[model samples]
Target: MLTLQIYLNRITTQHNGATLDYRGQFSNSRLIVADFTQFVNDIQAALKSAAEKNIYTPPSKLFGNLRATPICLDVREQLADGLSPVEYKVLLETLMAVCNSRAVKPEQVLYHGKIPFQAA
Candidate 1:
């Protein structure tokens, strides 16, 4: 099974930054490793594109908090460095947990390459 404790630093228009925690878990039986790998690959590709563009756009309002420009810069750096399987799986689980907690489908939170912006 995979587990994640996702912290969403919500950056609303009124609040610069607000930290929130969300927890979720998925078993190996629930997640096919190949699908997870493809998902990560797609994210990697999108990160590369965002790096070239110098900005990452959020797919949904739920991720708006993580939309700060500096976060994207950091993401670009992280993407350039590359992610290991463990990191990628953790990321996948974190996102899944966040979506589950928010009652938002994972597809709704899709922003393959863009940074999930958080600001304070």
Candidate 2:
């Protein structure tokens, strides 16, 4: 399986008119079903869609604590395959652990299992 790691930095304005900062990272690991390049394109497309649609609702608890612009994101992913059973198991466990992690919201974690290729 391959993995994608995304790092983001967000600057938000607090209700009291102060500035709040957030820096964090997340990952999505899955088996490579298509060529590596294609897979990357698909992921980027999904992330872009999510961002454009404003699908990621910053946790309501943080309302009034952030601004809408100046959000920066960096992404990277593992491009190789052939993981040992132990490694794969650890990956799956990690995926599960973050599946519902408070640190990362479900919408913020963008993923689509299938990569669309050009029509044959």
Q: What's the CA error at residue 14 for candidate 1, in Å?
A: 24
**Tens-place lDDT digits, model 2, residues 11-47:** 1222233333333222234442223334334444443
The list of candidate 2 runs beyond 4 A from truth reads 1-32, 57-120
lDDT (0-100) at residue 72 of candidate 1? 15
lDDT of each: 0.32, 0.31
Candidate 1 stretches with Cα past 4 Å from truth are 1-34, 57-120
Residue-level lDDT tens digits of model 1 in 10-112:
1111112422222222123323222444434444444344434543343346664354222211121223334334544455464444333333322222123
